[model samples]
Target: MSALDPSVAGQLAEDLPPDVFRTIIATFEEDLTRLVQELQTAHESGDQNGYERAAHSLAGASAAVGAVGLEREARIAMDHRQPEAAATVLPRLVAEAKGALEALHALIH
Candidate 1:
């Protein structure tokens, strides 16, 4: 599957003004970076609650932006009850986020 759902993104772009859409995309990028960092730190620190919280936040944000792959990965991360389990999925989650961001950026530019 694609990192982003183009139809959903296209709809969003069509519904919002150019500047507003750009702002949302920019905010998503910034939030994605911060959430991914939080996920990493939580994993490294063995903070399962923090890891799950970050994953949940990421999933929600990704969904809003039509970042399907990232949202899927984030949901998977959220499902993990243990830090070690979440750690296994961290790389995939990060990769998906990167791909999603790229796709989202393409929509605005």
Candidate 2:
């Protein structure tokens, strides 16, 4: 087993493993990418609902990983009356959150 194994950290194999860790990272990355793209599309098309939904999802995912700072930023972005400001903020949120998720995988794997 790897030194970073969750199994060695008093965690059970059934609850954690390298494969599961990778999947979690990949899933988060893919979703974040999609969310950012959707936010851009919404901004381009002036779709307020899409902006809100994507920003909401980004905030939730960021919060899940204890990324309260990013979550707050995302919330502020969502609060902006103009989609341009939200667009400017959404990419940073996605990038930083992706970094956090990758770091999480490294810690567990």
Candidate 3:
């Protein structure tokens, strides 16, 4: 498994201007934060469909930015279609995503 960080610069720097790459990273961060919120809300409300949506979104977004840990956790959560299973995975997914976000912030700054 790859280590997680905001590695967008390495992936996109060759093709994009530094400013634009930074913008992409910033956008990713914003979107991820929002998705995490959605996951939290869905988990709290026992909304299986909402949880799955948020988890799937998180998995895709994190994968795009090379957030391996977050992506892995999110994928696991996403695979849990049942409410009980999703609820069981939510804490770990949230924890891993938060850790990945911290790593991303450190890299961005």
Against the true structure, whose lDDT is highest? 1
RMSD of 3: 3.1
How high is the CA lDDT of each candidate model? 0.87, 0.63, 0.73
The digit string of per-residue lDDT tens for model 3 on 20-105 reads 76787788878878998898898889887898898899888888877888887888778764454655676777777677666655
TM-score winner: 1
- Among all windows of 10 consecutive residues in model 2, the one with the lowest summed lDDT is 1-10
After superposition, candidate 1 runs with Cα above 4 Å error: 81-84
Candidates 2 and 3 compared: the better one by lDDT is: 3
Candidate 3 residue runs with Cα over 4 Å from true position: 5-9, 81-88, 105-109
Q: How accurate is candidate 1 locally (lDDT)?
A: 0.87
Worst 10 residues of 3 by lDDT: 1-10
